[model samples]
Target: MSSLYGLRPLPSHGRFGYSAITRRPGYAWPNGARLAVYLGFNLEHFAFGEGLGARIGPASPEPDVLNYSWREYGNRVGAWRCLELFDQLALPTGCLLNTALYDHCPELVSAFAARGDELIGHGHTNAERQGDMPEAQELALLAGCHARIAQESGTAPRGWLSPWISESRTTPDLLAETGYDYTLNWAHDDQPLP
Candidate 1:
């Protein structure tokens, strides 16, 4: 295919080549189940005023209390409620966590860990985008997150999901070098890619 940007070639992550699903061989879920479902519960933290966040209303000046409190509500109340529901349902969950939670609410992270949920690395905070960092800084971010999660959660994460689903061109390469087995950043295919 022609390069979308003409002279400037499209950046490639080099993780996997495109393959049509119809041309691929069939695969079955465990016990021949037709489908599978699991909860990807995001437990994130953000800087109080000066970082990226999903605004409920129009953007305001520093210390966006309205949006900050809105997100904080998840950690303070919504997460506990959801935990109760998950317990009642007896469901397995994959907790995509920001390492900042260790500092913000260690108890909450522990609750999920106690329930045997898979803890996946989700950067230090959603306030910053990984794609914007220089390669060295990005590497440090990935390594720091990995080390922190492993130390706090008692197990290193095997998967990753960059905050805001943002990624630099070398993100997959960095993930592999940082010992991640998979990433949630790419969701174009129904099946996992190599």
Candidate 2:
């Protein structure tokens, strides 16, 4: 084993373009301030039917559910509840969205857009996890996710988190190629890392 272990050198010069607004130092949460609360939804509740066949099949739970009402419930009840809370607090909230939500409830998607809320894609489907697929498949899936989310959400996704916290060896490169501005999958630092 080498004495250097796994340590790698970091750039010693030049500034990384960044800033903070409505914030103070030593907080450095983002934009130089502490985040009061970050609201995120896996957004997969829509695909509960396809992902969890029980939600739709004969083996379905005794919920007497509609064809695919999970997202509708999420948007109408869950999202709205969250929005109302934020409104009461006048707080800035973030949303973690999944691609499938667009298909399930376009109006809900529009609501988020209308509010100008922060959004980041969680993935195409709640259960179509990425970390287990082959590199090529992962990349293709990532590309498809980006396109679908943009088509439905009315904006190109700037970041991605993942369904079920899943990822493959190639997730990084694939995410980069998919035109993401950043990712929150491998968080392990006091500050955000690329």
Candidate 3:
């Protein structure tokens, strides 16, 4: 009887099964804190005009410099400023990182790693959606992201956030099989769920 009209049906016997919010037992966060706040600091890279991206203006022809440059600025300047602010506030962030960011700007990624932030895999790029890829291709994509981030960051990430929040039917299976501890694709929960 559980359903959300447009979404695919919840998987059977999945890692976390369906239960009414009211029926679940009360939970307390670590340190008995009533609330937990973690920043999702996204550092992404994008392919030019070939895949999905945000734009500062209306879409133009190929090689959309307007939009591409806008996104690039985040890596070049904005993210660094944000990191400084986070440091000033003495906050720890959960870095949502695209593997492509390592290729595009390794130093920037290093800045976050050096700050003791937790790097969460965010795929290779936001240019393409993973949801429509074939099963094998999707698996490779997942593995590639994990490998590249591990190689560059010196530690494999334990969490994932699909590129553009895109995912295939088997994304969860891929995550579990490939050694990721959790994913951010599910947005309904305020707390991490098993």
Clashes of each: 0, 3, 0
TM-score (all chains, Cα) for each model: 0.92, 0.68, 0.89
Among these predicted structures, which one has the highest TM-score? 1
TM-score of 3: 0.89
Candidate 1 lDDT trough over 10 residues, lowest sum:
1-10
**Every model's Cα RMSD, please?**
2.7, 7.3, 3.8
Instruction: List residue ranges in candidate 2 displaced over 4 A.
Output: 1-37, 46-72
**Could you give candidate 2's per-residue lDDT for residues 1-194 as a string of tens digits?**
44369766555323134345335345455576666455654445444445532244344453436645654576668877877786787766556777666776667666667777767878766656778788888887778878886776668888889777787756777888889887788654445654
Relative to the true structure, candidate 2 reaches a TM of 0.68
What C-alpha root-mean-square deviation, in Å, does candidate 3 show against the real structure?
A: 3.8
What's the lDDT for residue 75 in model 1? 98
lDDT per residue as tens, model 3, 148-189: 888887898899999878887789999988889988898876
Better of 1 and 2 by lDDT: 1
Model 2, position 117: C-alpha lDDT score:
72
lDDT of 1 by residue, 1-194 (tens): 35664666678656678789999998677898888786799999999988799888887788888889999999999999999999999988999999999999999999999999999999999999999999999999999999999998779999999999999998888999998999998888887666
